[model samples]
Target: MPTAELPSATPPSTAVPAVDLRGVAVRYGPAKAPVTALEGVTLTVAEGEFVVLVGPSGCGKTTLLRVVAGFEHPTDGTAEVLGAVPSPGRGTGLVFQQPRLFPWRTVGGNLAFALARQGLARTERPARIMELLTLVGLPGFERRRTWELSGGQQQRVAIARALAGTPRLLLLDEPFAALDAITRERLQEELRTLADVTGTTVVFVTHSAEEAVLLGSRVLVMAAEPGRVAAELPIGLERGPHTEVAALRATPEFARLRGELNLALTSAAAGTGEEGQLPPAS
Candidate 1:
């Protein structure tokens, strides 16, 4: 059976720069009845920092991501990627829970599509595409159709597609949520290694505290349904195998943080019936 993992409520932080959002606000519909997703949400993530956003499902975490990706405009405040207002096709890469691959295109071709949109030179594009595949551990799977790969492999392709732009910041919204436990854990490890190797700034959204602790340098606890950063939690740990989930989880610090986050979720659920009504899924 499936179970929910818990997290501590309080989080500590350090200053830096992968992404910074100052007073960002999102309202759907009218001004009076507008649904506010995020407000006065100021955060700074340094280069190469792996920050995870954890919260109740409706907290607008995805909306926050859409805003940062320049897919949705913030009704108030600003979202800056590398010191500039983020624009679509800008130096910001996005990975969603679904692979969203183009069925008509081969894996390599899908990547090429992204690079082509950026106007990369023809001569340089192929090699770059190959490198991206290899980086995501999909080497030589290039000519394969998107549907040919397994769920995990398809997500790898998506990551490659996201990196096709060599983005300054990578935004991922529960990309591994839909996978099986084993597969999800494997991808978590793969992403950690990739983060170390590429020094890419990663902003990830996840519901699993274990996943967040395993992959994040810092975890920002959020409340969904008009999502907002309610609290922050720092893993204060290093990256490594989970050989013992029960054992590591037994530590006082880990348990404490987990409980705190769980409480935040409880609070988020209290007022979320309103926010969840806006979209099919908030």
Candidate 2:
């Protein structure tokens, strides 16, 4: 297999934040009565930071993720990734709630297609495919059909395929929401490890406060009816491979942060407006 360098629209730069959004808004429908999915969203994700967006349904969590992914443009303000306006084919990878893999192709075949698009040569693809499968904990399962794997395994493949492009920023919209509790927990740990190993900046969207607390270095709580950031809480708990999952969650700090975030969500839903713009956690 030939090794191909991942294509990047913008060169790497530590000076630029992984993501920058200022007073961003997204609206749809007619000029007379447009649906506002998001409004007054201001966020900045530093390089290698794991940030989670949590909010109620229709709060525009997914909409904000799409804005960063370049699938949707904001109606106001600026959105930038890696120092430039977000664009498709930029150094970013996306994983959705469902594992959107091709059933017709084998796991390896699916990965091969992505690698080919990255300009990796046919001869170089096999090795790269194995490497990716291994990274996603699917080692030597390349030849298996997508339909043969369990849902968790299939999602792993989807994640591996996303990483095949070697994205500098990884955007996930509730990727593990559909999984069972046990499977979701396992994937969360794996994702944390993967992030540490790859140093890829992550912007994850989830409705679960526990998931947000477990996976995010910092959690951004959003409110509905024109989504906006309501609170930002930093998880000071230990993370990555070194941390014990059950023990960490059981700690006092973990519980405290989780409680705070839940309160923020509750306030947002109740429309108290009291939690309207807490300063970003330092």
Candidate 3:
């Protein structure tokens, strides 16, 4: 038995889900020519838990994230957040792979934009923005323009903006997929701290198995094209530096787990990795 120490599941005390998906499916265009982005999917994210979904391109990972973020409606089945259907700006925050900040806005202004939606008082926006920047280790970066910052820094600002609303649910769609190794690790550490501090529920999508293993309390591996959950890996690693990339990569167990997931992902991609046989890619 692997001895990794992950966050515990909800104890017997409470049972309400922060987010729930039951037999959800999506299709575009006419029913006969429907493209299944997700099919018969079901999952639950408990309050303050972090769940990561890993899959290759065209696996409907983004579509799933959007469903939770309230950006996309499911064609069938139920998807709810906090016991209600989520809508745009409904206590959910989103961070994408790109910063997507307004070119005209400064870093502070971008975050202020999120706060403004909640009708925060004018006098409080700056303070809130500053606090967020500091949280992402971008202190004193309030005056920096979007184009002026490096790619990694821009992502930090994007995350800060998403967090501006003090959202109960935060959805990250490959937000750090583009960053280099060092930057990725730094941001990952900061995110762990942020999650611990705020008790925010997070559902993030990624292509890397190692990332999912390191940051997530539970990992859901989705199959490509008409994405569906193929395998779920619970992360039992202790928090802090051990959660760091080097520490994780240094372990033989890590390598073995990564190999398992790689095989799982490879199978997921070809839609035939089940039954102990690898399928040819489509």
Best by lDDT: 2
Error of 1 at 160 (Å): 0.4
**Residue 81 in model 1: shift from native, Å?**
1.6
TM-score of each: 0.83, 0.92, 0.89
Model 1: lDDT of residue 248: 48
Task: Please give the CA lDDT of all the candidate structures.
Answer: 0.75, 0.85, 0.80
Per-residue CA lDDT of candidate 3, range 236-265, in tens? Answer: 676763356677778876776677677768
**Which of 1 and 3 is the better model by lDDT?**
3
Q: What local lDDT score does residue 45 receive in model 2, on the 0 to 100 scale?
A: 87
The window of 10 residues in a row where model 2 has the poorest summed lDDT is 1-10
Model 1 residue 129 CA deviation (Å) reads 2.2
* lDDT, candidate 2, at 127: 95
- The candidates, ranked best first by TM-score, are 2, 3, 1
Estimate, for each residue in 43-134, the C-alpha lDDT of model 2 and write its tens digit: 78889989999989988899999999999999998999988899975899999999899999999999998999889999999999999999
Show the colliding residue pairs in model 3.
4-236, 5-236, 6-236
